[model samples]
Target: MAKSFQNFSILTSIVTLSVLMFSQGMLDTAHAEEYDFVAGIHNEVTFHFRNGIETVNFPVFSTTSDIVSNIGSSFEVEGVVGNNPYLHKALDEAYLYRMSTLSGGNSFEYNYRYFDVDVNIVQNENVLKSFKYDNCEISGYSVSTLTDDYESYLASDTGFAIVNNIQFRCGGVGINLDSDKSSLNSESRSFTDYGPLPFKLAEDVRTFLTFEFDHGSEKIESVIFTLTSGFSEANDAGPSFQIITAVLPHPLIDNAIDKSQKVSGMASTFNEDFDVSVEFTNSQETLRGLDFQDCIVSGYDILTLRDKEEGYTGKRGFATAEILDVTCSGLAPVNPAFDKLSDAKESRSSQMSNTYTTNSYNMGTGPHVIATFDFDSGTEVVDFPEFYQGNMIARANPTFTLVGVPGSTPLLYHVVDNTQGSGPKSTGVSSNVELFDVNLVLAYGNDVVRGFDYTKCRVVDYIVRTEHDADESFYKGFALTDEFYFECQGYEPFNPKYDELFETSHAKTESSSSWKEKQRDAWGPGFR
Candidate 1:
């Protein structure tokens, strides 16, 4: 049976066709010349919308000179029009959005749709190559309209359509058309696979159309859009669809005023990882880090809606960052963390083996204790500054009496003793206005354990007490001693330039050796 068609007529006012033709020839075109431009005649196109609705329509294409040869009839398939229709409307909308960039609108809105188109290359009666552009969209487009009057005989509206990402598959069967084929074989065999996936036809596949109208009826007489193949290669394959699963870490998105997200104002194809950084409005840092582990970023902006009572607020501003493909792993808590208070108690108990109470006297073997502070006038103190353990006596419960020396015109008037009670919160003490250094000293048989030379110091806390108040039996019959506790600082370590005041004292008396021997005997053989 011989199938034939001639002088096909396109009925609809608007139509879209995707063509990715090759110049080098598909299989073997050594003996074949250039393929003449031919028309693709599909009975209908089915459009799939965002709301899941489907519509089948016959999109018009001028075909007065589109004559199908008997030999080329073998390329025709026996089926309904392809399920995916060329996205003509989507492409037009995308192009208009691109044009809007000139006026600072900076917004594009569209729902992605799928469509299929075919490209045929013919030389006289023989069709050299045929391909199907499946799941393709107009990634790019431009228009130029011309009206010419030559002797007032005829007028025309002509335009050229530059399309991209039109996948071309040979024999019209599967995706990844050139994957199994070699580079040389793929290049010479596939139509547009040589570029990027969703291969685009750059040079020879552009469509040119002209509108013809009848002046008497003021109506369009015919529409002609041609797909020309300059060469025929039998191995030439067509376009295909790639199934991509959304990966993470994904892109950074902004919460619009309406809380919608966006990627681009027009069509976008991300072949490589996009690296972008953004800072929030009124943020201190130039770029803030984001954690988008698993997100399917909405690639387009969500347009505002309107009702009679509530009007649309329009699109809000937003920032965009690239979607990254990465893996995510869980982290465990930190092990063997340190606690300062607990560690201090343990250390003191382990080394000293004894504790002291407030105002109690103990004469035994212990870590050497002596310290000194020098401060300049005008220094203010609020709370006790933690002293370095090596520079101070690290005892379980220890206190030192603070004595005020006269020449400096004392900022403090009492002698403070070590105690375990919560001391009075002293209004900060400020040193005398005159710049002079006041010396503080702790003596142990004329030897100092360590000296801390502070540039300034003050009494941050002061507590006064009578001996009877602390230990009732110790002080009887109105003969009682008063004790004070003071905490202070507003000072920093001063320069110890050849200063002997900072040297630790290691002087020992006869009593010290006796105490050491007693400690060793008390601990039995376990003492080291």
Candidate 2:
């Protein structure tokens, strides 16, 4: 069996950035080569491709000269990756979206050509650089060769030559977005460094495809090879590179192996410890020091769904979650895990609604404080996205305070000390246009069953719900909802907005638990 793909060597350009696919070899660009057979006969050929500089063999049989090989019969195209029919469709849709560029539609076109194998001897590089490159136009080309009469000598060579080299071209447009990424879990599929051809590789990139086949009586039906590969009109601000990744679909297996994988989209703004650090300027130095002694962080073991926007619900209890290396202001790390609880009850972690009541306070003068946290890689954040049924963890939690000088909106504020009373409804205040209430929930006897933790967790951010212009300060309507932090996690775990803001994502993970439930899950499944 053979896999098929198109839109090779696409190049697009804009003001300063230009991205395009570049690869060299037997695969330039060809459309779905359609071939018709005399029915009943299977044409077998050794389909060889470069898999990480290593030649992988894929022996395939086609009943017709069509470029699209009927997968699964005569032989099955096997690779380190599984075959995904849907993956191609989604990528095609995304390619179309990228091409639309909204208004730059006419500039795009599809060119078709046919080619006989073209080989170049690598005198300096040793070995043959033989590959398929465009040689002639294929407007009304047909591959009905040998004999249509099954009674005559059989036809097969025509089936082997048909290869799809369809290339979609784009120019003078800027279309680079990941919204077209498929929602399919990588687990059931495998990702490969897709080049123009599914079974080729570059010099340095170690990713490629391999193939195997299943001998069967059923013959492959139609093979349609559409276009030949060619992408032009590409200009770059400077030297550039692009990688084409393909998500392949997998066939059903009895005791399947690894087919699912994930990639995260966390912003590049968090530190390795998963703490949200902010850069703010103020009138004082040494704003708040040694604040960890009384600092507390409630324990939890669940994930929350976060809306990308400021004030709204994304999705709650989408998956189980975990928090580790909890370090506030560079304190010792505390690890907590939570179950994926339902979104029922109130689970929106809001600063506007949760700040509750604020009292004017004066905390003499001090210095300005500024911090930064590097965003984790998508490889890291995707390790436990609620979308996938797995437990997630925040590497650390940092504790900090937003102290204001005289005449600020709410006067003076503190992350923990500003709050009155105790328990879940405690309130804290901050008048800084960019300040959000911070809380430190203590961890002594703090592990609550079903994700809720009594430990004093630190309020991580300010949920600014009002919309304003650059000149208008958010402090005009600044008010924290309260310590009733609900459960919620956004798509970007390390989003700058959520940085240092209060989050109560475990609120709906598990409500007040009963004694029996605690005995079974308090220490939970992983405990000895």
Candidate 3:
């Protein structure tokens, strides 16, 4: 954007006189009061502009052209009409009169001239872009013809007008609205001075105007503006101070999309009570949908944009990275560098691969894997495992030894019910009761576990006990029994030593001398 902002300086040569000061050669023409430049134009619609202590009047003779240049930069001033440059020059003959301060110190610069059917004004920090009177049916009036048809312009006057696009900047931190986009605010000064605004000096005031936001910042906790007009340090009877404050409701979070800060109350300075919320998302899909090239790095307000995506106005998002760690007692080889989990057919892959690609999965059985996550910043690497739901590979068909303790309940398989064991038809007793610990070393289906959370579905051991019993013969009162060595088909005896026998009662004669020798046969040397 070009530098379009500059203050207009007034020329020192223009002077207002109480008595007529015209040339003696022209003294015979007409009224000397016409030469008073500060006198407002009354023929058409009365109008006057202020520059601190001075007020500018409409030209009386319609012959001068240097007045507007003395006041400010030239932009086809409203009082003068037509695209033709010279026809407009004739309207400059009007003069301006110096007026007293109707209010505060000369703190504001006010200037105006008809420009494109509207008045253009420079009011202090704000620029009055346009001010138009629609109710006044005046037309066909030019600088050269205004004096002649000044009465014609006023003849069709109504009582309404509108001021459009008064542009101004409120720059700096704590100076911007929440979820905001623009630094420029547009205010309107309408037909309040009994005319189309700024008709005279005393009526100029910026009241109850919202001071909700400042410029150059979005994370402002709160902003406040005090509108104190009548009470400048020089005037006690000036305006009372009215305060307006806007506070942010919540702190801005990282990668959260469509966020906004609500006004603390119902009234605020914003055109709308709430601004466009911070348009951002942490979702990768959402980011890709937008001009993804402009994704913001990590934690920033919604207004922050990437250099490459300067023109992108859509919401933003963040990137993601994660890792899984597996610590197993019976694993093949620790390969943190292995990419495909399929490689860990009998071992774990080094490179963090998808857990789904592992050889086979197991829950609480041998070799379980754990996983760790690196969310937005991807700065974390894991040592031990935690959140993974698969199995590991080790010895497959594990061997179990058979040894029966004299008293302790054994992990029985194919346990025969009392009623079934008592029948004469029963051959060998081995049927219902059971307890088997299903421990196995399995491998991964993949390196990484899929889905939102770890889908841990592994086949471990289920020790079957009497958690539910509807019959008494199921676990009680066995009749006929014999010594039976129960063991898995291909397994060897564990040869576990025992200290005592369970329910065998002996006579005093056998207990007296050779009790140790007789019992030694059943439990060997453990009878003592």
Give the winner by lDDT. 1
- Lowest lDDT block of 10, candidate 1: 215-224
lDDT of 1 by residue, 451-498 (tens): 444333333223211111111111111111111232333233333333
As a TM-score, model 2 comes out at 0.14
* 2 or 3, greater by TM-score: 2
What ranges in model 3 sit over 4 Å off? Answer: 1-272, 278-376, 379-528
Q: Which regions of candidate 2 fall more than 4 Å away from where they truly are?
A: 1-282, 285-324, 327-528
Position 430, candidate 3: lDDT:
29
lDDT of each: 0.23, 0.20, 0.20
Judged by lDDT against the true structure, how good is candidate 3?
A: 0.20
lDDT of 2 at 422: 17
lDDT of 2 at 361: 28
Candidate 3 lDDT for residue 16: 22
Q: Candidate 1: list runs displaced more than 4 Å.
A: 1-442, 469-528
lDDT of 3 at 220: 19
Ranking by TM-score: 1, 2, 3
Better by lDDT, candidate 3 or 1:
1
Cα lDDT of model 2 by residue, 1-528, tens digit: 122222222222331122111122122122111211111111111111221111221111111111111111111111111122222332344355554534554354332111222222122233211222222212121122222245223433211122222222211111111222342223333323223222211111121111111211111100111001011011111111111111112221100111110001224422221121111112232121111111111111111111111111111101111111112222211111111111211364322111212222222342111111111100001000001112335543323323222112121223222321112222342232122322222111222111111122333322211121211111121211111111222211232234436654554455556655777665856873
